[model samples]
Target: MRFLLIVFMGGGLGSIARYLVNKWVGGTLTSVYPYGTFLVNIIGCFLIGFLIFFTQRAGASTIFWRLFLVTGFCGGFTTFSSFTFENVELIGNQQLLLFFVYATGSVVLGLLATYLGILAARNI
Candidate 1:
């Protein structure tokens, strides 16, 4: 019960943050690309990487933080499902070039962001 509540709180916060980012990005950019979801996913990956390494370096179990931040928050914040759906929509609309760019860029940039986050955490 306690663990559930902690995850619930973290997930709620993450979801809210995701919503705000979507709104802000949507308002700022009017394009076929799913920039909002792409940005959120990359950011989530970076955050999870940083938190995992940082917590491990702290030399404590920190299970609660992991559950809340990594599992709950990141699970809620990242939108891989939405990313796939958007890709499908692009394909349906015959935007093959944009689809490939978005898909490949998201994957590559997300990995790079995670690696950078890990390096940042380690250096700190």
Candidate 2:
């Protein structure tokens, strides 16, 4: 029950952060590429990687923190559904090249970002 409350709080904060980022990035960008979701996904992946690495290296043994940050926060921060819907819309609009680029870029870059984050945390 206590763990659930912590996760709930972390999720709420993560959701607000995501919404703000979307408003800031999405509102400013004039492209149909869904930059907001792309950025959020990559950032969330990076954060998860960093947190995992850092916690393990630092010997932080707390399920509450893990659940709060990884399962709750990062889960809420990233939007796979939005990314897929944007891709579908792009394809429907016949923007094949952009769709391909966006889809591939998100996956490749997201993974890279996570790896980089893990490396960074380990090195630090």
Candidate 3:
């Protein structure tokens, strides 16, 4: 029950953050389709990788923080849930090409975006 609560809280935070990013970025990003989503995914990816190393070095989060940051925050922030749902709809409609485009585009652009985010953060 406690674990569940942790995840729920974290997810809520993640989801809200994701929403804010989307709202801010909107269609005006003017670089890359779904640039906001791409940006979020990239940021999420960078954090995940960084967390991997940091957690390993000084021990990881307590169960609660893990659930909050990893499950909730990262989960909410990225919106792969929505991404999956949309992808499923595309696939169901037999829009295989679009599905592939969405999938590959999401991955490639997402990765680049994340790397950029990490690079910027590191430099800063």
Candidate 4:
């Protein structure tokens, strides 16, 4: 239906954007971590937060926009698979403390960001 088409378009563009970020940060410019994924997730989080606030305060966000930006773009941008793989790689490499930090920080921070976004939206 129309909803599916909107999400599909948004997800396709989001994936393309992710590819560009990956290429930009791949191997040459950044090292020691998956900088591209990190950048995308962080940017996506902030954007989701901002959008939530905007959607709440303005009261003008349509279903199509929500499907596109949130269900599609944010969904496509954040990578649970990459996060899990990184954690496993860290653990396999005997970086226990590093793995702990990454895993804990990712979950905790991501949850906190979502909570804060909701709170901001409600208050504003």
TM-score of each: 0.61, 0.59, 0.56, 0.58
Count clashing residue pairs per candidate: 0, 0, 5, 0
What is the TM-score (0 to 1) of candidate 4? Answer: 0.58
Between candidates 2 and 4, the lDDT winner = 2
lDDT score, candidate 2, position 102: 100
Which regions of candidate 4 deviate over 4 angstroms? Answer: 27-30, 79-124
**Top lDDT hit:** 1
* TM-score rank order: 1, 2, 4, 3
In model 3, how large is the Cα lDDT of residue 50? 57
User: Which residues of candidate 2, in runs, are more than 4 Å off?
Assistant: 79-124
Q: lDDT of each prediction vs. the true structure?
A: 0.83, 0.80, 0.76, 0.77
Model 4 residue 35 CA deviation in Å: 0.7
How does residue 20 of candidate 1 score in lDDT?
97
Tens-digit lDDT string for candidate 2 (1-124): 8888887887888899899999999779979798887888878867876765666676657676877886678767875634665687799899999999999999999999999999999998
Model 4 CA RMSD to the hidden true structure, in angstroms: 15.9
The runs of at least 3 residues in candidate 1 whose Cα sits more than 4 Å from the true structure, single-residue gaps closed, are 79-124
Which clashing pairs does model 1 show? Answer: none
68-101: candidate 1 lDDT, tens digit per residue: 8876787688755346656877998999999999
Shift of residue 74 alpha carbon in model 1, Å: 1.1
Estimate the overall C-alpha local distance difference test score of candidate 4. 0.77
**True-structure RMSD, every candidate:** 16.5, 16.5, 14.3, 15.9
